[model samples]
Target: MIENIPLLVTNISYGVTFIITVGFGLAVYLKSSRKTAHIMFLFLSLAIGIFQICHVFGINVVDGESSRSIFTGSLSVIFVICFTIHWVLAVLEKDSEKIKTIVGFYTVAVGLVVFYLINPSAFLLNSVPKLYLPNYYEAGNYYWLMFVFFTVGALYAFYTLAHAYRIADPAHKNKLRYFMAAIAIGFPLGSTAFFLALNINIDPIYSTLFSIYIIPLAYGTLRYDVMDIKVVTKKAVSYALIIAGIGFFIAGINWADTLIQSVYTWVPIWAIPLTSSILAVFIGGFVWEKMRDIDILKYEFVTVVTHKFRTPLTRIKWASEMLKKLIPVESADQSRLAVDEIDNANGLLVELTDMLVSLRQVDDINYLYSFEESDMCKIVEKAARNMNKHILDKKIDFSLVCADNIPSVMLDARRMQFALQIVIENAVIYTPEEGRVSVSVTQENGKVVVSIIDTGIGISKEDIDHIFTKFFRSKEAKTTDTEGMGIGLFMAHQIIERHDGDMSVSSDGIGHGSMFKIEVPKA
Candidate 1:
């Protein structure tokens, strides 16, 4: 046992440092605002972290050789399987091919798990406890087959990423580059531990090389926002805590189960109950925090919806009162005015209800609008005209520039018009009185571009990033218009994207003005 001290220390230090770095990476990943490709990455990190903890325990803490072998064999295979899945997903966009890859990986993962359980010794043979840190293992016949499978998977992943990098759009290419660079350098350097499987007796010195991957991973997450993951604050913290809980549980379960042969040899019976009580407190706190977060989000959604409802209800009440008073007057003009007022109020109520319903079920749109191939320039013109009231009220200098012979596009005309109207209305609302708002449409390279430029209180740099997020209102916009629900841009952005187009915003700075740009493929 004395001879194993250095090995114990080395494995403990390596395992602890690796886990901590992975934990930090998980935190950064959870903070992302757009979680597209991030779910796979999260699972990969989690698997590696689990494998490390189990590996360290197998080497230094577990009493029996078979127990240690069982732990390492099961976890190592799982780690490789997750890495393979993450690799395929990170490179491919969501498509039928991606589904195939997922299915293939899952099959392989399940097979490996079954094989390891049936006979862990088949994958992990006799282990030689040594004075040196690296242990010697007798090679199993199936070991090389697993090694070759992983090697091929890693190579295929690199090739797929390279091919994707060559064909990706300019906006996405840089993200692929960052991911590729990290994987290329990190995975091989970290895979050095596999040498032990061949009875090669390689030290775990290169184990920490796995941590280097976190550097580029973080840079991509923070600098490029590559994965487009949205991590709400409360949810992120809760998930982080839960993941940590899981990690502790996995590491502690075996120790607790085989308490007599392991660390519990020195402990008294009373200590077990004390430890259990402490764990219960932690579990209780995690559950309570998650519940509180859910409650907060629910409260916020209800409050905003209630406020929006009140505006239209107030207008309807006023219209009803007017109709009641005018019934006795017997004047045609007064009756006509009351009828028009009621009609307008009903329209507003319908609009508000549709908006809320659409938001709730954004994926379904059959009731929203009819789709057809139509002149996009005409749509832009109509949308701009609908916002004429707000524009004239603000007395803003506005111009609409349209290129001749513009191409037609497939769209739900009324929905697209409503989307564009929302943007233009926002431009008018945010602009100061007498400020300029420019609406321009042009055809370029098989796409039609519509831009709305406004010299208003511009969005702050930080706010511009989240401008299209649901229920997000910038501080500057809030001061200007308290009645705005901050969902207009979100709705508009969603509509534009649903039509296979894109919408983006740019601003120089506050007081410097801003621009909302849209692009759609021509029909």
Candidate 2:
């Protein structure tokens, strides 16, 4: 049991890492944003956490296979199976948008539960006893089946993460790359421990080695924000190597203990010191990286801060220049000109402030808002007129048609305008030169409906649900000359919801035109 220290440490570390990862996944889920990748991510984290906890604490952790353990461990089977299916869904699913990775994962989850529920046989527990080892804690013969399933599940989970890590964009590439690398290293190590536990090797030392993997996992997650993965993996590798070094030290202590076990019941139990030394060695290197080379965080921080200052600075300059020219002719009406010029600068300032606020709020997925009353017709016209230059440049025959009986609605004017702009801009982006883009408004069932109908490359049904997702662009969107950030529609969706409105998109399939319908409650 003493020899199991390193493995226990590794397992505990993995368990901690798993907890944080799952928490992050849930955070994204609660934000009214849903995506296959994120949902799969949540399940994967949840399952990994569960497995790590089981390994670290063992099934009899609380009271050695007590009824509580059975219940908890049994419940974990569902999560494990779901994690596996999360991968299978990704592997088999051709449609990127219509996938329900979570709900789909749960299907396998149910199967796992039902099988165990019907048969609480040896696969789950050999004997429900108060103590975990030496007497009541022999693994059931059918435990191999569970091991088989778990192995398959872990493989699929890792596979999905691996694929995601490879294709993620630069903004997130490094974090994901390291996170996946951590998973890659730990999963294999974990597998080795699993096989060893199953009589492949009856050594307690394997458990210690397995437990130590958690340090790397935790380091990857904490040091690099691997959950929100960005590019830059040097720190992650450093973290892993630290874990490796610490692992060796722990191994040394285990060796020392075994030597003493040959002579005495125990030695000073020096593994903790060795573990700390390993951590210190790696962490020392981490500190050195910041001093010796460029840090990505430094660059990101500067970039974000500079953008804040630069945009407003440009706006202020433009406003000043415009005022300067006008003042040369209109300076005689001093007070009036002064007020107008100040208002111009103020308006730009207000716009900049609002942009920054929205940027921050948008990061919160669950952001909701208060609604105000405004004219739908005016809103559509305003958005179109605002982007008139873009319309002309694109050669899009943009038009706004409103039914004579169309009514005003209760909504946030600024938000509605933003939504309208996104939809229109998206239409313009998707539409080819000379292609027509029509914005039509109508009153239907006590609602004001604004539709942006484009005669451009249409979205397929499979891709429609994903259009409103953050950072989700269709293959078509990627191929076009359109330089899109893919957040326009997502932002629009949030804004519409804040206004007590609803937005939906439809496309027949590939090459068919798409329509974005936004409906807000009539005032």
Candidate 3:
């Protein structure tokens, strides 16, 4: 029993590694499969899981079969390296064509290595029982080639990440640093298995702890917003506590079953599992209902608070208007300026109140919307005119173009104008002084298409997908507009979707520009 302890511990390490790698990979993939980085991570995780499984079985298999099992597992390393490169490039937002070209070359090379690995004789001589691992394989003629391939590929990935980190912005640099640290710890330690293959006789204690890197990797990815994963802290903690409770419950059942069996030997074995299953269902349903109730309460609280804000905002607006009227045009410039400041402050407060109301309505299932046929050009023009003050303040080169034959669209006129204003406002706020903002209204494919383009701090590829997500703000966006709530686009998108229209945005990356297109069906 004592002699088997090392094998047991090693197997446990592999098992834990497999669970964590696959779990995170699946979680990320399920969250956003369209992202190339997520997909590559999933593939890489499966490769690692397969390798671990093979090793787990290889260590327990007969000596004659052990070599084949371990060697077959070795084939997965090629895929691991290939997918790692792809994942890194994707995360770094490398040029798509360049990523394809580089990853394609590695893929072809991996295919060749996979074919070579199939004939184990090309890379493995034989297997021998070792101190830590149950079976350690001896290197054959071309085994060095495997090491070379892995080393070269891993080094290249590390180099790329290091280079990116050096020149990356503050936010991106932190994420890259986390990734680099994780791989730096995981790869080198895990590669100790290669030393064993070369018959160096070193025990792979480091391999047993290789999965430790996942801690930093997961933290960086989730906490730093590496991908567009929106993790609600409350939900995550609640679920974690629930899962822990269930685990404790299961253990308690087992303990009780053992105690009962000791006291009454005739009790049927099926009773414990059956009783536990029923109790689990009951508890799960109870927890789910409670969670739903909590959501309802949260929404209700927000609704009440949002409604309460309207009264003060209206009074402020009225007071500001009165002040503006009381101040004569021929009076001191300071008096006029003071009134203007008050009006501006009031306007900002009103806009915030409106945004809050809209946010509340978005969560209200029974909120009614009035839809009518409204001229798209007029709506666009109105939104632009409303932002004229901002345009003049920034000295922006703003232009509006309306097609002569533009069609009217079915929309809630007030909501649609609000949505348009949100998009136009973002354009004005984000663009630097003297930058250009253009709005065009035209009819295309039986739909009214409104395009708003701006020269601003453009959205990154990663952020563009999540720009419309509630409370999601890009690093640059946050820096550019410190007072932005990050909900305008989200509310606007929701409003447009309710009108059976579509909203989309494109950017040529940061410091370039952005284009937002809204399409609504013609009435």
Candidate 4:
């Protein structure tokens, strides 16, 4: 057995560290902060990760140690050079000088790679006595040049950090100090690994200190909120829990396997399914975290995009109103119709913008809500009035039946109005012409219940379950109204849930109509 315990342990540490650094980079990218410096650092992490993996393989994969070590060692050195240049670029502001330096560095890196490929013996000797693995390469004449290149690149990166620190604003000084300190401590410790190539045979484990390089980045993330990257702390803790659980479960599997083999006559077939289920949980947690992160970015994006679109919409509405006032009374009916259409279009755009903004705020726990004791009957009446035009146009018999002495509920009036409006309007849209759309409010089970029943295309059993999911449109609804964005019920559900209320829908299959009931606590 190749019993190099220390080397094996070092490889394992490298593997774990690589996983961490790479995961952090991916999480940052997934957050959609999209800062250039963040991307550069991610690239730096990736390069080092490749190096660590290669190093592990060099030590463990014995059959091709000679060639593998040389290639991995050489490739790792190149990556170090690449990261060094990228690090400098990340710190410095972009300019003509920066571009020139980048181009020059790229040229030099390419030249060095070509030189190494053509005459690798000048940098690494192919033949050497086996150490712990197989035959390994030794430092050669050109090796100093490669070392000098890495040393220069690293020094420049540190120099850039120091320079940035000196001239930075006082507010930024502490953050830069943290970064400078991390690079100062981490790089030197990691650099000692280069000595191993020179036959110095120093303790190689210090090489893993590269992982410490991320300490400052993480500090920057939490302390300065650097790169505008926001990481939910609880999510991070959850990830830690997930990782620990996976480790514990893996250990348990091994222990169980051993116990079964030793103590029992045969292994149980059920063990495989049990192991798979545990693994599925671990995988599911990881995927769930990713989905949640993406959802955050999605909401932020929605907010920005809707805000941009809202500006033009506001201008259009204002301009159309102004034009209407300027038009003479004797103007043709066509002109009036065109002006009316513009006003209608502008209203739709305004409503859509508001809906997008509200949806974006749905996931935020600290979302502002002005709650007060408001009459539930008055709220529902106002919502029903807002949809009176649509109900009338459809010739639907829409009635608001509110019980006398209906108690007030503590709620955000505007949001509650919006929620109720959505429910009522959806009822008007889906109900067939001349169908009945009735809204009722009453106290039930110590809570105020608002129910909207529509005699129109009903929801199927399968569709009812998913009706409240964002952007989910039932087949019936899609055919009935192709323009529906399918967010009304979703927004209504979110608003009600936030108001300490419950929203549910029931239907007796398609063509039988549906009922939406919302129950909020009475004040």
lDDT value, residue 406 of candidate 3 = 79
Each model's TM-score? Answer: 0.63, 0.47, 0.54, 0.48
Question: If both were scored by TM-score, which would come out higher, candidate 3 or candidate 4?
Answer: 3
Q: Which tens-of-lDDT digit does each residue in 277-351 have in candidate 2? A: 676677678767774556456545655875777677677767766766656654576654554546544543454
Prediction 1 global C-alpha lDDT:
0.68
TM-score of 4: 0.48
Instruction: Please identify which of the two predictions, 1 or 4, would achieve the higher lDDT against the true structure.
Output: 4
Residues 286-374, candidate 1: write the lDDT tens digits: 78787779767865785578578867777786777777675765566656555655654465455555666565455333445556998
Query: Which sections of candidate 3 miss by over 4 Å?
Result: 99-104, 224-423, 426-469, 472-486, 489-523
TM-score of model number 2? 0.47
Q: Given candidate 4, what's the lDDT at residue 452? A: 96
Question: Is 2 or 3 the stronger prediction by lDDT?
Answer: 3
Q: Which candidate is the best by TM-score?
A: 1
Candidate 2: where is the Cα deviation over 4 Å? 1-40, 52-75, 81-378, 388-416, 429-435, 441-449, 457-512, 518-523
lDDT tens digits by residue: candidate 3, 163-278: 99989855467778888998888888878988887778777766755556655665665653332354443344446456546755875797799799889989998899789889
Candidate rank order under TM-score:
1, 3, 4, 2
